[model samples]
Target: MTNYVGSCLCGAVTFEIEAEFESFYLCHCKHCQKDTGSAFAANLFSQTGKLIWCSGEDNISSFTLAGSQHQKSFCKDCGTALPNNHSSGILVVPAGCLDTDVAVIPTAHIFMSSKASWESNVVNIRKLEGLPE
Candidate 1:
């Protein structure tokens, strides 16, 4: 397993994950769009229990949306979003936040039904109307 290290934009929070590259997905869900302020969110899904907060855990802030089961984590100082664990027992890491190069590229696009109208289409990906099962 490769060791991947990442930090918030302000360097106030740092974390590490010891795992091999897993699947990557692009989520275009409305909640993710608004939370990231982007057309979509690129996520690297890996097995849970491989992530470790090396430092600055106190600087990490969490927000759980109303009626949503997922909790998003970010750096309190720089607002850099961090990886979060879901109730399903998976670690969802933002691909953009990784300091190391991921071996696998995004293989699918999720929530295509809510994709931004102005967003450019990506080629060669399996587009799903909603989250892939």
Candidate 2:
């Protein structure tokens, strides 16, 4: 029964999700790493959520990998990831795109076998509030 609002980095696409997320996952699949250009993709999944496009819906584009369930939706302007409402009735929303603070934490890290080799002992890495001087 939680509602979440999100927009793209360029503010070209906006949407609202009206349902509680069933799970949150940090995905380390190669496809996710390549699309996000990061160690993993933080995603929130909901089976019954409804996606409401608030603005700039035309700016949203989607791509589904051939022969795979892997799909990505993004803002065509800034390339920021957005929600993917799959035909299978699962809605996958990128956690980073939400403007609202999420109460749900990651439920698990998936595809660990494909986790980046450089991510070893990442918890021990130095924490900085800003870019190094």
Candidate 3:
């Protein structure tokens, strides 16, 4: 297993995760788009308990969206989104926050049905209307 480090945009919050590099995904769900204010969200998933908050734990803010099981975490200073625990106990880390070079390529597009029509197709990746099969 490799150790990875990450921090929020304002450097207020930092964390480390001991995990194996794995494939990522681009989610186009409406909630993701609104939460990120982007066409989609890039996410890296890893097992729970491997993630450790190295600094600024008090600066991390969390919000539990209505009707959703996931709680979103962000830097209280800069509002930069950070990793959060999923109901399944996995850590869903935003790809852009990682400090190490990521080796995994995105394997599939989730919630593609909600993806913007203007977005170009990802070459060679499996495109699914919802989650990967």
**Candidate 2 lDDT by residue in tens digits, 12-36:** 7888889799999999999999999
**Residue 61, candidate 1: how far off, in angstroms?**
0.9
- The TM-score of candidate 2 is 0.97
Q: Could you tell me which residue pairs clash in candidate 1? A: none
Clashing pairs in 3: none
The 0-to-1 C-alpha lDDT of every candidate, in the order given, reads 0.84, 0.93, 0.83
Residue range 1-133, candidate 3, lDDT tens digits? 8888999888989999888646588899888888898888899887743889999999988888888765678998998888888777788888898898888899788998998765665565777899765
- In terms of lDDT, model 2 sits at 0.93
Task: Assess the local accuracy of residue 3 in candidate 2 as a C-alpha lDDT between 0 and 100.
Answer: 86
Model 3 CA deviation exceeding 4 Å by range: 120-133
For each candidate in turn, the TM-score is 0.84, 0.97, 0.83
Best of the candidates, TM-score: 2
What TM value does model 3 have?
0.83
CA shift of 4, model 1, Å: 0.6
User: Lowest lDDT 10-mer window, candidate 2?
Assistant: 84-93
Clashes of each: 0, 0, 0
